[model samples]
Structures are given as C-alpha cells and as structure tokens.
Target chain A: MNLKVENVSYRLGKKVLLDNVSLSLQERERVAIIGPNGSGKSTLLRLICGLNKPTQGEVLLAGRCVHRYPRRRLAQSLAFVQQKANTEDIVRAEEAVSLGRTPWIKPFEAWSEYHQGFVEKALLQVDMQDKRHQYWHTLSGGEQQRLHIARALAQNTPFIVMDEPTNHLDIKQQLGVLSLIHHIERTMLVAVHDLNHAMRFDRVIVLKDGGVVAQGAPETLITEALIKEVFEVESRVIKSMGFASNVQLIA
Target chain B: MLVKGLQGVMKSHPLLFVLVSTLTLSVFIVLGVAIGETQIDFQTVVYAVANGALGTQYPINAIDQGVVWNYRLTRTLVAACCGSALAITGLVLQSLLRNALADPYLLGISAGASTGAVLVTIAGIGAGALSMSFGALIGAILAFMFVVALAALASGRRMGNISTQVILAGIAGSQLFNALTAFVIAKSANAEQARGIMFWLLGNLSGARWQEVAMAVPVLLFGLMIVLWHSRALDAFLFGSDAAASIGIAVKRVQVVLIFSTAMMTAVMVSMVGAIGFVGLVIPHAARFLFGSSHLVLVPACAVIGAVFLIVCDIGSRTVIPGQVLPIGVVTALIGAPCFALVLIRGQRK
Candidate 1:
C-alpha cells in the first residue's frame, strides 16, 4: 500500500505541533522519521494512522482519503502498534494477538479459521510461538514489544505504523526488532530516535519543527551536515558490511 | 495443550455439579419458608406452597397461608432474583469498564433508588405499601442516567476513561442522596414512620409480595440475555480500549449499552427489595476464582453463586434469632465482609 501525506498540519491549543508536512511511502518501502525531541515525529505518525486528524491537509491511503473511510475498513488496511505496554488485565499473548482479527469478525460470531491462521503465522513471525500461552505480565519488556508487533502483523494489513518502536529495548532486542521489520514484506513507517538504527532504513526523513527538512535514500540524506543541523550532533556516516550504514557521533 | 487441559477440568465437573448445587439451594429456599416467628411446620409450609400454586385439596390455615405463601415465598424468590440480577450486572459492568471494582451500586443505582424512595416517603405521594418501591425504581433509573451523562461529558463521549469518573460520581451521588434521606427522616412526626424508613434504608425482604416478583423476573431475564450477548466484547475490553478497537469492537457503544441495561436491572431489583449490598461486589470475584475469568463460565457461575449466597443468608436471617427476622442485607454484609477480606488477603499473597 502507498501512503501519501498531502500538506498535513496540526495544532494543539496554542502550540502548532506540525506544519505543512508532506511525504509519501511507496509499496514495500521501509522509511524512518528521525528528529530531536518535540519535532513532531510521533505526531506525524499519529496523523498518518488516523488517530489524530491533520489541521490543514489530509492523508491518503491508496488514493482514498483516510478520514472518509470507515474506521474498520481503514483498520483493515493499516495497523498501528503504540508505545505503551501496560494493560489492566492478565491476558495471554495469543488472546492479545487474536484481537488483530477484530475487523473481520461479525457481532456474536466466533473467530474463524482464517483469523486463527493469521494469529498463528504472526506469532511465528516474531518467534513468539512458544510464548503464546504465557501471560502478558510475565514477559520481559522486549518480549512484550515483540508480542505487540506480532499483534500488528496479525492484522493482515499491508501497511504498519509504529511510534518509537525501540523505546525501552536493549541493544540486542533493538537489533532484533529492527531486523524483523527489515525482513517483513509490509510497508513500514517508524518514528525512531537513534540515528544509527534509522540508518538501516531504505529511506530516511529528517524533520525539524514539524516540517520535512530532508528525505531520500539513507546514505544520501544522513550526512554529517544534516546531523549537525537537525540533531545538533557532529557525526560520521560509515559504510559497513551487509549493506548497512553505521553512524559514529563525534565528540 | 492448555485448551485440552481446560476442557478436561470442565468435563470432570459438568452439569452434575450445578445440579447438586441447585438441589441444595432449592432445599434451602424451601426451608427458609418454614422458619420465621409463626413457627409453621415443614409439612404445613409444603402444603401451603403446593395449594397456593395448584389449588390442591390440602387443609391449610389462612394465617399460615398468608405468612408462608404470600410473604415468605415471595420474599425468598425476590431475594434470589435480586441477587442474581445484581451479580450479573456487576459482572457486565466490571468487564465493560475493565475494572474489577465496578459494581451496579458503584455506579449510583442504589443511591438513586434510595433517594427516590425517601422523596416519596417525605412527600406522602401515594404512601401506600407499593409506592415506596415505585419511588425507589424511579430514583435508581434517574441516578443511573445522571452518572452516565456525567461520565460521558468527562470522557468526551469516549468509554476508556469513564470508569474512574463514574465511580467517583456514584460516591458523590450516594452521599447527596443519603443526606436528603436523613433530612426527611429527621423531620418525620410519626415514630413508626421513622422506624419504617430506617428498615427500608437498611434493606429487608419482609414486605415482599407477588406483585414485586411479577416486576423483577422479566427484568432479570432480559438483563441476563443482554450481558451474555456482549460477553465477547467484554472479553475484548479486558485487553484495553485500543486493543478492543483495533479488533473492530465498538468499545464505547458496548460500554453504554451494558451500563444502561445493568443500571435498569439494578433499579428494578433495588426498588422491589430495597438496597441489598455486597452480593454484586463479591460474587463476581468468587466466580472468577472458582471458574476462570472467561465470561462463558464467569457470568453463569456468578448468577448461581449469587442466588445461593443470598438464599443461605436469608435462611440465616430467619433462623439465627428465632423470633426476630433479621434484615437480609445486614446478614449478607456480615457474611460477605469476612469472605471478601479473606480474598483480598489471598490476592495480596499471590
């Protein structure tokens, strides 16, 4: 699925959060939004996911206005995995993942076989097949994030939006989550804080004060001058093995 | 593997356990009619109930018939219905709000009913025996609507943040209603009227009648069906709003429907039998502990356990003092408080 943000802007009370931000993601594109704190990175993702409406412009998914689509229909096309992990009840991981099939279920009907298959496949994708029976409260932070990702995957949507997907993860789990995203066939738009992690994306979008400052292939846009201007840091971008771009912050 | 394990556990206890429990409760319900100050014999009670229902050729005294058939039997059935209704309402609300502490009374139904009953008493508006129950019903429904409206306003018509606000509003509403009730009772010139008001406030099934049962049974059944139909949505809500909404569940609509229906049931039950406490609050937790949190098991189990608990409490109320018929509400609190404390302690240990 292709996502097009056409001149989107948002304001909260007296503060303008996003200003004329327009971008697009083609099919199977892995894109990262990188910026300093309060640069509207998370807000941009929320707008794209239709959780918050833009003040001035609109978001289009496959050439249809997202706001005009029914909520269930929109949900069927795009899934969002939020940053929060605290749940009020003790639910099994499988039960949580099965919720991804809500758009396909009718009132008073049992879950169908296709929904079950999707949940199973999604769990297996995250390597959480063994933990399907475990309580969500018993899992580690990284495991819970992975479980949430699996739930998003189970939605069977071609597009996935994540906000700060690596917030509380350690270095190894961080790499694991990014690697899983890299291997998935779906189009992904992730808001990330780490430049090195953002370097692994097919495209990088640098934002400043809610406007798109630069966007293109990661190697072309993640320059030392861009880092100093957008992130207030002196950095070097190096070419590494496995077609990976590595970043080292200069002191 | 876990599914098979759960199935095995359920199979081991099938309908046989429910049948045994139901049989024991029926015996207790029948035995409850035999007690009371009249000292009616077991045979007389049985003959009275059968003759009352079937017009059998059994010789039964008029006074015994009035006490057993007209009074004790109706009260017992009302107690059972009220208990079942409140427990089911609590289960639905708890699941809807995703809060274990959510109960029918916690949403201001009891307070509203109490306020309505007190207003009717003070104004002498149709001060007949049945008017008090009617007034309570109106008050409960009004209070329920007020709390819902307040919660909706606070949450921007969203269901996720309404639970805590609804509870707080209920507390405020209860206090306001209690103060009004107290003011009315203070101004009463007749000491007998004061005593009647006190008894009603404390809650009793002593004045139970066939008319009350006629009103309660249908509401209970309707409420049961509504809760059961929304059971899957309730399960989704337990995972949280985003999770539920992500799954295509309309969380707000389900919350509104469940709250209003449960409140309607609560109002009718409270008006008929006064404000019986603790059954709604405690029975769902007990049901969850016995059967897991799955609504398929928890909801029906809550109804059964709630009915049995109140029946046993009603029996205790009659037999414990011999001559004096204790208020069923007081008995339930006395019995339920200690058990609730035990559960709390156990939960902490866990």
Candidate 2:
C-alpha cells in the first residue's frame, strides 16, 4: 500500500512537533527518515502508523483518509515496531509474536494454522526461533529488538513503520538488523540515526525543525552541503567494501 | 527436542493439574455443606442436598434440607462466585494497569461498600427491609462512580493520560470512603450496630442467601465475559499505550469498559459476601505461576483456583474449630499474606 501525507501538522500543548509536512511513498518502497535529535522523525512515523492524529491536514493510505480506515483494517495494512525493546517480564517471545495475529482473530476462536505459520515465519525471519520460549526480560538488548521486529513481521502487514530498530545494538547486530531490513521485500519506513545505513536505503527523507528539508535518492540527497546544513556535521560518505556505504567525520 | 519436551510438560501436567484441583474444589464444596454448626451426619447431608436440589424420594427432613441446600449451599456458591469474580478482576486490572499490585478493590469498591455497610448499621435505616449486602452494593457503586469521576476530572474530561491518574484517584477515593466509614461507625447509636458494622467491614460470608447468589452470578459472568473479550487488548496493553494503539486497540475505551465492568462485578460480589480480601490480591499471581501469563489461560485459571482457594479457606474457617466460624477475609489474608511475601521474595531473587 502507498502512503501519502499532505500538509500534516501536529502540536503538543504549545510546541509544534510536525508542521505542515507532506510526503509520499510508493508501493514496496524502502524509505529511511533521518533527522537530528528532537527533529520529529519518531513523531512522523507515529502519525503514519495512526498512533497519533495529526493536528491538521490528512494522511491518506491509497487515496483514502487514514483516519477513515477502521483500526484493525489499518493495522492489517501497516504494523509498527517501536524503539523500546523490553516488555513486561512475563511475556514469552512466542506469545509476544502471537499478539500480532490479534487484529485478525475474533474473540474465543483458537489460533488457526495460518496464524501459526505466520508466527513461525516471523521468528525464523528474525532468527529468534531458538529463543522463542525465552521470557522477554531474559533476552539481550539486540535480541529483544529483533524480537520486536519479529512481532511486527508476524502481523503479516505489507508495510512497517519502525522507530529506531537499531537504537541500542552493537556494531555487528546493527548491521545484521539493517541487512535484514534491506533484504526484506516489504515496504518499510524506518527512522535511522546512522547515515551509512540510511545511504543504502532506496530513499531518504531529511527533516529539520519538524519539516522536511530534503528528500530524494540517497546518493543525490546525502551531500556534504546537506549534512552540514541539516546535521551540523562535517562528514564524508565513501563507497565501501561489499557495496555498502561507509560514513566518517572529516573534522 | 527441548521445545518438544517443554510442550509435553505443558500438555501433560497443567491441564491434569487444573482438572484435579477443580475436582478437589467440588469435594470441598460438598464437605462444606455437610460440616457446619448444625452437626449433620454425612449421609443425612447428602440426602438433604439430593432432596433439596433434585427432589429425590430420600428420607430427609425438611429442616435439614432447607438448612443444607437453601442456606449453606447458597452461601457456598456465593462465596465461590465472589472469590472467582474478584480474582479474575484482579487479573484484568493488573494486566490493564501493568502494575502487579492492582486488584479488584483498587478502584475504591471495597471502601465504598464498607461505607455503605457502616452507614446502614449506624443510621439503623432499612434494618428490617435492606440487607447489609444491599447496603454494600450501593456503597460499592457510589465509590466506584466517585473514583471514575475523579479520574475524569483529573484527566480534564477525557480518559486519556489514564496510566497513573486512575490509580491515584482510586487511592484518594479509598481514603475518603474509609474516613467516611470510620465516622459513621464512631457515631453509631448502639453497640450491636457497631459489632455488625465491624463484622461486615472485616468481611464474612455468613449471611449469604439464594437471592444474593441470584444477583451476583450474572454480574460475575458478565464481568468474566468482558475480560475474556478483551484479553487480547490486555496483552496489547503490556506493550504500553503507543504500541497498543498502533495495533488497533482502542485503549481508552477498553480501559473504561474494563474498569466499569470489573467494578460492577466487584460491587455485586462484595454486597453478596461482605468484603473478602486477598483472593483478588494473590490468586492472579498464583495463576500466572501455574499457567504462563496468557490471559486466555490466566483469567479462567485464576477464577477456578480462586474459587477453590476460598472454598477451602471457608471450610477451614468453619471447621478448624468446632462450632465457631471465623471471618472468611481473615482466613484469606492469613493464607495470602505469606504467599504474597514469597512471590515478592522470589521476584527479588530473579
């Protein structure tokens, strides 16, 4: 499903978080949203996932107003993986993943074979099949984040809006997560902090002060001038080994 | 291989364990009917129950049948229902609030019921017409409404931002109702009224009646249905508000419905059988330990185990000493406090 945000604005009390921002995503697109701290990247993703209503203007999913869609219907199209890794201590990994099927199952019906297959696939996709029986609190930070991603995958939605999927991962785990996202065929809107990983995405949307500053193909949009303008950093983007981009500070 | 082993354990043990526990509970219920202050023999009690329920051609006296089935059996059922309802309510509230300490009475239901029971005892109003259970029901509903209103006021007329505010409102309302109960008790006109009020406050199932059971069962069943219907939503809540909303749960609406339904069920149960404590506070955690944290299993497990626990406690209260029945609440607290302490200790070790 394609998502279109038109002139969307949001305010928290008196402060504006997102201001009249507009963006669009084509089907099966992998778009990275990158911004400096407190630049409303997470807020924008929340708005897209229907967790927060826009203060003004509209978000359309395939030409219909996003709010008009029933909550389950919207959830069936898009799932959200949050930045917070830990849930309650009692939740098992498999039970946590099974929650993704909640929007589809009616009350009192036993989980069907299709739901089981989806959970199995999700656990396999995140490579957490071995840890499926572990308590949520017992998992390591990166493993918990992967489990969160698995939960989103178990929803079997075509699109996923992720808020910092690699927030606390070590270098190796971060690459593993980014590589997993890159290899997946579904549309993903991810808020990422690392420019190198963002560069590998099909598209990047740069935000400054709650509004879109620049958006285009990663190669064209992520220039030295834009980095200095938006991020206040002096940086170099180098084409590195294995077709992956590497970013470094020049100063 | 490990997964298969775990699955085998779950399949082989938990269901059989719950089944055995349920059977033991039914036996306790039957035993409870037989061993009371009246000193009826086992065969006579069985004959009485059969005569009362099935109208069998048994040579049972009318008075014994009435005492066994109409009075003792009804009280037992009411106690079981109240225990099950409160435990299930605790399960739902803990899951909803994401707090281990939340219970059925967390919304000021008990204090409200206490206040109403106290008021009736002090004023001597409706002494001939209204039962203490009715007074408790009124008090519980009022207290529940007051808390809801306080929450609404704190949240500026919206149920948003309810995570901490509802609990705070409940605490404030509890204090308010407790003070009111104390004041009413202090100004009572007679010593007998004070004793009655005190007994009600301490919690008892001595006066349970068929009429009370008739009122309590449907409310308890309704509350159970509400919790079961929203078990998935409760699971979503454990992920916190944003993730829950992202998954298409109407968090605020579900919270309101759950709280109101739980409070209503609690009021009915408390009215029917004074203010039994600790069953709600400890049984859900007990259920969690036995059957993982899935609400699908947790809710029913808590209900069943809670019923059995209370039935056994009531049996101990009645039969532990010959001819003297202890307050049901005291027995539960005696049992639950140590269990709660153990859970906390274990949690700290973890």
Q: Is the docking of candidate 2 incorrect, acceptable, medium or high quality?
A: medium
User: Taking the tens digit of each residue's C-alpha lDDT, what string does model 2 give over A136-244?
Assistant: 8888888888888888888888888899899988999998898889877898899999998898899999998999999998877888888999999899877656775
lDDT of 1 by residue, B246-341 (tens): 555655677778888888988988987788888998998777655655565567677777887887788888788877877778999999999988
Model 1 residue B21 CA deviation (Å) reads 7.9
Estimate candidate 2's alpha-carbon lDDT, on a 0 to 1 scale. Answer: 0.82
**lDDT at position A171, candidate 1:** 93
Candidate 2 chain A TM-score vs. reference chain A: 0.96
* Every model's TM-score: 0.87, 0.93
DockQ by candidate, in order = 0.40, 0.61
Number of the top TM-score candidate: 2
Task: Please list the residue runs of candidate 1 whose C-alpha ends up more than 4 Å from where it truly belongs after superposition.
Answer: A47-56, A61-71, A111-115, B1-49, B52-66, B123-130, B156-160, B187-192, B348-350
Which TM-score value belongs to model 1? 0.87
Cα lDDT tens digits, model 1, A1-251, are 68999999998766899999999999999999999999999888877877667888999999998878776788899988887645655457887787777676655565567778999999999999999988778888888888889888998999998888888999999989888888788999999889988988999999999899999988878888999999888888888778767889999
Best of the candidates, lDDT:
2
